[model samples]
Target: MGKTTGTRRGAWAAIRRLAASDRAAGLIMLGFALIGLVAANLPLTYHLFETIAETHIGIPYTNIDLPIGHWAQDGLLTIFFLTVGLELKQELTTGSLSNPKAAAVPMLCAVGGMLAPPILFMLVIALFSRFGPGEMGSLILTTTGSSIPFGEMAHGWAVPTATDIAFSLAVLALFARGLPGSIRAFLMTLATVDDLLAIILIAVFFSSVNAWYWFIGIAVCAGVWAYLVQLKRVPWAVVAVVGVLAWVMMFEAGIHPTLAGVLVGLSTPAREIHGETTPRAERYASKLQPFSALLALPIFALFATGVHFEELTPALMLSPLVIALIVALVVGKPLGIITTAWLSTHLGGLKMAKGLRVRDMIPTACACGIGFTVSFLIASLAYTNAELSAEARFGVLVGSLISALVSGILLSWQSKRFADATTDATR
Candidate 1:
């Protein structure tokens, strides 16, 4: 019994370490994205890359039929989203979001971050429509010569609205290491709300279920999940099985299956149970965040970030769709984050997190624009045409690059300033 308990402790320790190394995941994602970019452009490797991304993987007995890329997107990505849901649940129950006064600023900032990007996207499209020739039509809006309708392109607006929490947190871990703990909490809360909003957008706007019964089935599953989580001692394995079943049902219902992650994660108890020492949210995160950060995200990046440079000409690069995404991500994200956060603190009477000023927010807010994983997903969902998808992917890559660079410089500068001030005060 002693030996068994020691082994269990060792395993949990390893899992905790893995869960903590999100910075490593970010670095690995960056390296793989660079490799994907290189492989996509190299003629010798391009065929292999496409094959790997497009290969079909399914259980024929169960009638599961999707490309390997789709599996990574729809199935494995749920693990990552589940971790996200766990974090959100923890915050809402016991962390930064538990306090209404403290939560107000970041929550408002998240709302701003979501609201500003799409409006800018539409406004930019409108500007192009007004001034440019009919050839430069917006991706979602109807232009003089466009074949795509307004409804389709409108879906793409949510692409920039999402803040890739993985990448954003990675940046915070890397450059803002010296900042106050509350700043990290603030950003996490903001990103959580941002993700919650994105998930809602996917459900309301993107769902295309064929029958009402499918939703009824999902609702029943969710009700059971909620009820089970409230119990003192419940079978987690059974919950896992039910979660998978619900995912399949959601997929069949034409809703994005990853919402399964959100549902399960949210249903988990963030507080400690009667018999357990650890909270369910933390327990679930320790077991799952490692798989999510180390495997799921990297694989998704490998499949999604491979953009062939040869296919992108000057015309395609400068197309209204591409340009609009770039501008929205790089400009609109920071603008929305800052504007709304400022309003919350100054006008709405919410206090800023300790040791953080409005000045400190600029760099972090800019980092919020790194809408990598979900942005690419939304882009694909928004446009079925390969050309449009490729262009949007390229735009996301460029915009994230720009956001990373600018935020990196600014964060480094801010850190230096804070350090120097501390030194002076000590003297």
Candidate 2:
């Protein structure tokens, strides 16, 4: 019994260590994504994987019924968003974002990053319409042999605008050794703001309200949560129950349920309360980060990346939509970020963090091109046609992979330069 208990303890310790590692989390999610892709393409396993993903399991008589895939995307993914919210709150209250002067550059850069992708997407569509497979003014044909109108195709403009905070941060942690800490801070601020913008886009464009009155329940739950967290001894169980109720309300209200996680996270107090030394937001983020990193994100990646590559043809691969998405993420993201940062610092009178220059931001800009998580979510929400959606997702996957590889290489090079400079200084 003693030996067994010790082994169990050891296993638990190892699991915790893995969960806490950003590199491990990123690698695990990537591995699972590859597994999902392979599983989706293999004839023998495709049907099984599809069945598992499509199967629904939810409480009866509730509006919570969703397929396993959606449960990962909308349900389990909320935990990760909640952690993001907590981190955002901390940054706003006390971290990098607290100072308006310091925050301006990243905020503007985030706006630039968001704006460029959609413009590029529209430009690509215009080019395709004017030049490819149709008359100068006619609809462009898609890989699925459908000619969608320009307006319909434009719905996917937001798909490549997102930057996956988890993946971008993971790459930075893994490859950015010996670089300035300010770079990480800048990346975190930029990614957080990027996510905030994506959340707004999801709420504004993607939501289809069925019952507006359900927001009353959400408000009440949020109120209760705010109240509970302020108590001397917070009732964590009650807080969790209230949070679930808020999510249900949000879902029933026709808003995306994941927003509830952000709502609750923002509601959590960032200041120390009840004589606690550490703030509740920081503690909550620390506790939840492991779960978000280990399970929620990997599961979401598994379903989100299960694109059937076997179905893609060479012509489809070269489709205007695919080309646009890839270009928007890979080229537009970095271009917008670097340009905005440079303009903000040089022209707009905003200063970057000390010892940081526009040139130092190149790798960070490339890292911002990793539009995986929220990008995948937006792709599904952007298109009702299954084939179009799959193609859009494929574009996101390829674009994000290219961004990751490029950013990793750049970060390593930058780290080596920094190391060499330090060695020379020591001499």
Candidate 3:
């Protein structure tokens, strides 16, 4: 038994090492996503994406045939959310979010981050609508597009507000200078809050009419999962069964099935985590890491990247969607986060982290704009209609790129500056 325990520890350690390995695949994934866009525009690749989207699956008993595109967006993606929920649970329990003081700066920053982009988006629309002849005017875009660059057509406003946790956190860890651990803790907390808000937006503003029965099923399964956790059952079979049930319930719920992943994640007990005297009930939920990292997450990325770009026009490139997304993610996210963090510290009496100065704030704020996964997920969830979804996707692509580029540049620059300053001060 002791030998078996050691082996398990060894295995867990290996997994941890893999998770820590700098072969971080998100950059590769982003590269693929860029490839997907280029492919979308290419003749052969465009056709391929369209063909992939057409694939379908369904159970023997039902008329409910779900398409491959829908399945990726709906099914495997839920596991991503589940992982998010688990991380969130950990954060709330014993991670950075354990104290109200620690929580204040991130929470306020998150709110500011969420609020700014939408306002910019809406203002753009309002300007165009007020003057641009309401779809009748020939307001040509200077950015090489046929249509005007702002409107309800640009309703992809909310796409760039998300902060993709894995990618953002990974980059945060890359600083050669001794970046404050508190910054990571702070970013994670804000991103989590941003995630929860995105979920609310997806459910309330984005989804269609609910089937009450599915809601009941989701509620029941959630209750069962909670009960099982409380009962401290750890067998793989038990978890597999409950996890399956949770998936089904989420599928039935009007809420996207991917939300089940988050629910499961949040439900996990944090007591036994990494040898912290965690409750066994909390342990079962987090044990799904291998599936999440190695299988589900990567698969979801594969499917999500399958967008077609065949009918590429300058008009499309300069559309309200493209500009709004770029502005929101690139400009608004950092601006909002940095401004709010300062205000929260000064006005709300929240203290800033010890070592980080006002200059460090800009790059950190830029990093907060890394809104890849959650941004994509929300784009999928927020728009049910094909036209709307396309618009959202366009925004998501543009915004994600802008955020990643600008934020990355800022972080790298700040990291160097921080190091030089430290050296100069010592000298």
Q: Per model, how many backbone clashes are there? A: 1, 0, 16
- Candidate 1 residue 401 Cα shift, in angstroms, is 1.5
Please provide, for model 1 over 294-332, each residue's C-alpha lDDT reduced to its tens digit, 9 standing for 90 to 100. Answer: 788888887777866555345555666777887888899
Per-model TM values vs. the true structure: 0.89, 0.95, 0.85
Q: Between candidates 1 and 2, which one is better according to TM-score?
A: 2
223 Cα displacement, candidate 2 (Å):
0.4
lDDT values, one for every candidate: 0.80, 0.88, 0.67
Stretches > 4 Å off in candidate 1: 1-19, 61-63, 131-154, 227-237, 307-316
Task: Determine which window of 10 residues in candidate 3 has minimal summed lDDT.
Answer: 138-147
lDDT of 3 by residue, 1-427 (tens): 9999999999987875564442364555565556656665677667787677677888566445788777766777676677677777877777777786868888888889998987776666555555553355424242333344344355466777777766666666664246667676677788888888887777666666466787777667677776666553356577668777777655555566677777766665666644557654344345655556555656566556556543656666665555666677778888889889888777777877787654567776776666767777766665554544565566666666666666667777777876787789999
Against the true structure, whose lDDT is highest? Answer: 2
Best by TM-score: 2
Please give the TM-score that candidate 2 achieves against the real structure. Answer: 0.95
Task: Pick out the ten consecutive residues of candidate 1 with the lowest summed lDDT.
Answer: 137-146
C-alpha RMSD in Å of predicted model 1 compared with the true structure? 3.4
If both were scored by lDDT, which would come out higher, candidate 1 or candidate 2?
Answer: 2
